[model samples]
Target: MEDLNEVYLSPLPDSPYVKPFRFNYTQNGKKKTWDLLEIHDSVAIIVFNITRRVMIFVKQFRPAVYYNCISRQDRESNNIDTKKYPASLGVSLEVCAGIIDKNMPVEQIAKEEVLEECGYDVKVTDLQKVLAYRSGVGVEGAVQYMFYCEVTDDMKTEQGGGVDDEIIEVVEKTIPEIEEMLQSQSILPSPPSMVYALMWFIHHKADKFRKTFERTCVECKVK
Candidate 1:
C-alpha cells in the first residue's frame, strides 16, 4: 500500500469541505488580519475489540503528511523520488474517524465510521462519550467530538476498508504492544487524537478489560 509515485504539488482549489477566509480585527488600536480555514467538525472513536483482545485502528495515507515530509526542492520540482523518502512516511495509524457532513447526531456518525472504516456494526448507544476538544487550533479550530466503543466478532458485518475512493486498512494491536509503543521514543506517525484516546483507554478502561479477559480465559480453561 505504500507504493507511492508521481507526487506533485498544486494550488488550492475551491472545495465544499474547506473554505479559506481572512478576518480583520482591531486590537489595542492596531488592525490585523488572520487567515483561517472554515472546516467541518469531526468525530473520532477509539475502538476496542473484546473478541480479539486488541484495539482497532485505521491506517491510511494522508496527503498533508506526505507533502510536509518530502524535501522542499523535490516538492518544488513537482517530482518526488520514492527511493529516498518512501511512501510509508505518509501513512498514519489513526482512530476510526470521519467529518460531520450530515445533519445526524455525532454519535450516529461515529457509529457509521466504525462500521465503514473498521467493519464493526455497533449501535449508537454502544458509543460512550469521551470528550470534545478543538483541533487544528490555529488554522481551523474546529470542534472534534470523541467517543469510545467496544465490539466483538459478531459485529463484523464486512471487511470495512472505507467507502468510495478511500483506501484504508484496519490494524489491530494488543494492549502490551500498544504500551510498548507508548514507551518508545520514535513511535509511528499518528495523530494527537489517537494518542490521547489510547492514553484515556489505558487510564480508564484498560484494567477492567484486562481482568475480564483473564477471568474469561481461566473459565474456559476450567471448562
Candidate 2:
C-alpha cells in the first residue's frame, strides 16, 4: 500500500472543516483518478476501571444515527414508547476519545480526553496500539489511532474538566453490561471500531485485566 503514491491533478476545494481535492495517480501500472480529502489525525482511548469489569463510556448525541430507528412493528412488539422516540440519534455510549491537537503527543491526547470525557485522571501507561484506520472514508479522511489504558478508583473520583460546551456524560458499565449492550444493539450506533476494540480487550486481556485491577487498588491505598 505504501508503494502507491498519488499525484494531485487540480487544486483542492476549500471548506470550513476540510479541503477536498482531485488527484491523478497510477497503481500497479494502471492510471487511476482519486479524490483526496484532507483531515486531522485523532486518538481514542479504551479506558478500563480499577475493577477491570467496567469501562468508562460517554453518552452524547450523534448526527450520524438520526435515521437508525427500529421499524414501527418492531418497536411496538418490543414495547418501546413511541412518544419517546429519539428526535435524532440518541446519546451514543463510546470509549473516551478526542482529536490529536497540534503539538500534543498521542498519549497526552488520550490522557486528556479520558479526563475531559470521563472525569477521570488516567495515567497513559501500558499504551498498546489497538488499531488505526480512516473513520469516514467517503466524506472525510480522519485517521484515528486507538489505544488501551487502565484507570484507578482515585482517578474515577477526580473531577474531570471536560471540554467547554460539549455535553459529555460519563457512564461506567461492567463486562456483563457491555455484552448485553452489544447483544441488544444499544451501544454506540456507529463507529464499529469501538465495538471491535472492546471485543479485543475482553478476548486478549483477561489476565492482564486482573493484574491491573489489583495494582490500581494498591496504588489507591498508598495514595
Candidate 3:
C-alpha cells in the first residue's frame, strides 16, 4: 500500500470505464511515449462453501468480452444482429469481484464484494489474500488484488446480486465440476482470477477440501 493520491482528468470518448492518456518520459536518453488506459485497481474473491463442499461463482454478461469475441464481419453483418446476441455470448462464470472505488481498505472492499456478489457474511480477517497483480500491462497497468475465503451455512445473510444497477447470477459448483470447467475454457470463458483462484486452492488446500467433500458425501449418503 503506497500513498493514495492521483487525479484522473482525461477520459475516452463516450466510454465511462476507460480513461486514455499519454505518458511521456526519457527512456535511456531518448524520450519515450506510451498511450495507456487508466483503469481502477480492484479486488477478487474466491468464495468456498466448506459446509456444502462447493465453490461459489457468479454468472454475468460483460459487454467488452462480447465485443472482443465478435468478428469484424459479424459486427457488420445484417443477417444476425450483434447487439441481439451479446447476452448469450458475453455471459461468463467468474469469481466474486469489485473495483476499489471507495476510500476503504482493500480487505473491506473484498468483504463487501463477497457479501454483495456471493451472499455471504464474512469478516475482513477471514479473507486471505491470494495475489496482487497488474491486470493489463500492454495498454495500462491496474493493480488487482485477489483473495480467498471460506463460508459456512450460518453466513447466508442475503441473496447476492450486487449493490445496484447490476444483475449477477449466483452460481455454485462442486470441486469436480470446477475441475471440468477449468479445462473447458471455450464453452465457459473464465477470467484469470477465477482460474488462478482454483489453481491456488488445488496447490494449497485441495487435500483439506477433498476430505471435506468426502465427509459431506458420506453425510448425504447416510440421509
Candidate 4:
C-alpha cells in the first residue's frame, strides 16, 4: 500500500462557484503537487418512472470529451482502438444532476435538476446516497452526490424548464432496453459513476422500485 504524505501547499483562486486548493503530497516515494477545485455541494437524481418501466436520462454535449478523442488519436495512432470509433463524446446521457447553489439545500438541488434535465416534477424521496465521486480528476475536483428518485409517469407531460444555456434532451428507457445498451456497450458516453450507481439500484432496490411504480400507477389511474 502506498502511503500519502499530504500537506496543504496554498489556496488557489476562490470564487462564488468554486474554491481551489493547492496541495503537495508524496505517493510511492514520489513527490507530487496538484490543485483541488471544490465546487458547491451538488446532487444527482436517478428518476425512475415505474409505470412506464422507464428511467429518465438527459443528453448534452461535453467539450472535454470532444477534445479528448482528438488528442488521443493524434498522440497514439497505432495504439488507438479502432473498434471504439464513432465515439459518442458530446452526446452524454446521464441522470439528472446539478450543483447546489450557495443557500439552497441538497434536496432542492436534486428536485431542480430533475425538472431541469428531464422535465419532471417529482417529489424527491427515499434519498439514498449512491456515491461521492470526483468528476474530473485530472483537471478539476468536482465531487458529485448521486441519489435515486421516484417520479410519476405524468411528470413530463408539460414543457420542461431547463437552464437557458443548456441544450438538454430527455430520454426514457426500460430496464430491458438499458440492459441491451449495456450489453452492446452503447452507453459508453455516460459517466461511469452514474452507470455504476444505476447498476447498484437495479441490484439492490429493483423489487421495492417495482412496487413503488405499481403504487404510483394505482394512485394516478394510469392503467
Candidate 5:
C-alpha cells in the first residue's frame, strides 16, 4: 500500500458517486453563484465488540485525503515523491461506512456495511440510530446517517476486508487506546462523523464496558 507511482490527474469524468455543477441564485435581488458537487448520501456505524471490550474500526486509503496532503507542484507534475510523503499518510482509521446507493432502508444498509466491512452479522433492529447530519456543506451537502451496534465473537461471520476493489483493514481498539487517540494533540486523518461517533461512545458506553471489564478481572482473580 505504501507504493505510489506514476500518478496522474485528469478532469472529473462520469462517476456514480459525484457530479460537479455551477449553481446560480438570486437573493435580495443580488445574483449569486456557487460551485457544487452532487454526491450520494451515506451511512456510518459505531461498532462495539463487547466480548473483547474493544471498538471496531476500518483503515483504508482515500485518494482525496492523499491528494490534499501532497505538494501542489508534485500534484501538477503528475508524479509524487513517496519518500517525502508516504502513502501511509493517506490511510485513515474510520468507522465502517458505505454510500446509500440501494433503495432499501438506511438501517439495512448500515447492517450490511457492518457485515461487509467489519465481518459482523448484526441485525437491522440492533442498529440504533444515533443521528443524521449534512456532510461537506461547503461543496457536496449530502446527508449521512449514523448508527451504533454491539457485536459479540459469535456474531463474526467472516474476515471482512470489504468486497470488490475495496482493501479495508479491520481494526480493533480498546477503550484506553481510543481515548488516547481522542486526546492526542496531533491531527488524526479521519472524518468528522468518525470523531463524533467515538466521542459519543466515550460519553454513553465507555463506563458500562469498563464495569464489565473490571467485573471480569475480579472473577478471574477469584478463580
Candidate 6:
C-alpha cells in the first residue's frame, strides 16, 4: 500500500474536468470580454458529531485560498516563496466537500464526501440541503450546494484522510471553541465556505443541536 511515482503535468492541459475560456457579452450595450473558469458544481457538508457534541471538519492545504490571504505588506516583508513552504502555507478547516462531476444526485455526492473526507458513513436521505450559491462569480460561475448532517461515533468506519492522493486531516471542536474561533481575527486564515456553512448551521440547526447535546449517550459519555 504505497503511492506510485508522481508524474507532474501542466495543470489546465492535464485536467479535462476544468477549462478556461473567454467570451464577449453585452454589458450596458457595450461588448465586454470576460475570462472564466468552467468547473463542475460542488457540494459542502457541515457535519455535526451529535454524540461528541462537536463539529466535524477536515483540514487540507488549499493553495488558492492561501495565496489570496497573503496581504501585500506580509508578502513584501516576509519574502514569501511558494516552493519553499507549500503544505504549511494554507491549511483549510473545512467540512467535507467535492465537485459534482458524476451523474449522481447532489445529495448522494454529499454523502460520499462525508465518507471519503470525514470517515462518516451516512445515508443520503439524512443529508439536509441548506443552500445553493454561485462561487467565484467574478472569475468563474461554479455553483455549490451546502448540506448538513448529524453523525455519531458509531458512524465512523475508518480513519478517513481522503482517497488516493488527497491528504486530509479530520478535526473536531466543541461549540464554545467554534464560537470563539468564529469571532476571532483569524478568519483570513480560515475557509469562507466553512465559515458560511457554520453560520447557517447555527442559524438553522442550533435548536436540534442543543437537544442532542443534552441527551447523553453511553458511547460519548456526555454525562
Measured by TM-score, the strongest candidate is 5
Runs in model 2 deviating more than 4 A are 1-16, 26-32, 67-85, 88-90, 136-139, 184-188, 207-223
Evaluation by TM-score, superior candidate among 4 and 5: 5
TM-score of each: 0.91, 0.68, 0.82, 0.67, 0.92, 0.80
Error of 3 at 184 (Å): 3.8
lDDT of 6 at 171: 90
User: What are the per-residue Cα lDDT tens digits for candidate 3 across 49-160?
Assistant: 9998898998887766665666776655544453445456777888899899899999999999999988899999999888999876889789999998999979999999
Stretches off by above 4 angstroms in model 1 are: 211-223
Candidate 3, residue 164: how far the Cα is off, in Å = 1.2
Question: Sort by TM-score, best first: what order?
Answer: 5, 1, 3, 6, 2, 4
RMSD of each: 3.7, 11.7, 8.1, 10.9, 3.2, 6.2
* lDDT scores of the candidates, listed in order: 0.87, 0.67, 0.79, 0.66, 0.88, 0.78
The local distance difference test score of model 5 is 0.88
Query: Candidate 4, overall lDDT?
Result: 0.66
**186: Cα error in model 4, Å:** 6.6
lDDT string, candidate 2, 30-131, tens digits: 998887776778988887886545787777665345325545454334344435454444556677788776687788887778878888776667567788
Model 5 lDDT tens row, 42-109: 99999999998899999998888888998777777756777777889899889999999999999999
Candidate 4: stretches off by over 4 Å: 1-22, 25-32, 72-89, 126-128, 133-139, 184-186, 207-223
Query: Worst ten-residue run, lDDT, model 2?
Result: 1-10
The segments of candidate 6 whose C-alpha lies over 4 angstroms from its true place after superposition are 1-14, 66-86, 207-223
Model 5 deviation from the true structure expressed as Cα RMSD, one decimal place: 3.2
lDDT per residue, candidate 6, 1-223, as tens digits? 1122221223356567767789789999998998877788999899999987889988887756655656666555434554544545577777789999889999988998999889999999889888899866777789999988899999999788899989888999887777777788776656678788877777777666565545578797775
